[model samples]
Target: PHYYSLLAAYLECQKVGAPPEVSARLAAMTQELEARQRTALGGLGAATEPELDQFMEAYHEMLVKFREELTRPLQEAMEFMRRVSRSSARSPSRADRCAISFPLA
Candidate 1:
């Protein structure tokens, strides 16, 4: 269950901050995720219980953590976009616009 454990640890890292051992743990987790993916979707597909549960839990947990982390970045980006839109509507030159333009024709 080293792989499974590594995945949990990776989730913890992303939630807080990548731990000192995250480098090594992530490497292991990557391999494990790959193996599980292959097994689940391989040509000779066979439903696995324990392995599937572990991998699915890791995957779901990772995604949830990722989404949580992205909340701030996404909000910031949206705010930036709104600012840019307002700026562009107010003034073209100071709107963070690029001078380069190409004609489709």
Candidate 2:
């Protein structure tokens, strides 16, 4: 959907790269890829089919592996946020204090 929106914007801008037919084909492929990404965790509708169940299992395994890889960065971000909050609480005028605060519009 987002890809299609991008393609629509491109057509409106008349960038003149791909012809309409070729662009439509590419957009369809992009839509398929986007659908795959959306269902990477596999929808809950039904895994009645054998192949669908296997694919879902594989996708779940991949998600676990991805989460394992993100552990360090996730932990570091939490720690960093905690440190920033602590330092900001200690001094309101500190240069990094604004990192935790947003100005009201």
Candidate 3:
């Protein structure tokens, strides 16, 4: 939800020609999210033994599912980009091997 909100705000900022304001808003949102995360983590120390165990179990399950869902697509995309980069280069340079190439705007 916050990501969507931030994206919408960015689009709106572009429409309004307020790029600097978008940066400010993004920075503010990042700080707010960090603070929220810190607060939630601080509260975790107060959880009962059973609650902590349950929370850890759920978190581990979520991490496993997230990695399973994301890993393959991410690897495939990275490989595709690498292939594209190599194809575009006459000879893949040392720098190209260490860096993911992106088309310049």
**Poorly placed runs, candidate 1 (over 4 Å):** 1-42, 47-52, 91-105
Best by TM-score: 3
Ranking of predictions according to lDDT: 1, 3, 2
User: How does residue 90 of candidate 3 score in lDDT?
Assistant: 66
Per-residue lDDT for 9-35 in model 3, tens only?
A: 333333332357776775676567667
Candidate 1 residue-wise lDDT at 18: 51
List the global CA lDDT of all models: 0.64, 0.58, 0.58
Better lDDT candidate (1, 3):
1
Give lDDT tens digits, candidate 1, residues 1-105.
334445554554454435558756766766777688666565674556897778777776776567578566867888999998998788867435766668999
Tell me the tens digit of each residue's lDDT in model 2 across 8-85. 433333322457787677677666766775675365643357775566566555655554565657678889999999
Clashing residue pairs for model 2: none
User: Could you list the CA RMSD of all candidates, in the order they appear?
Assistant: 12.5, 16.2, 14.5
Q: Number of backbone collisions per candidate, in order? A: 0, 0, 0
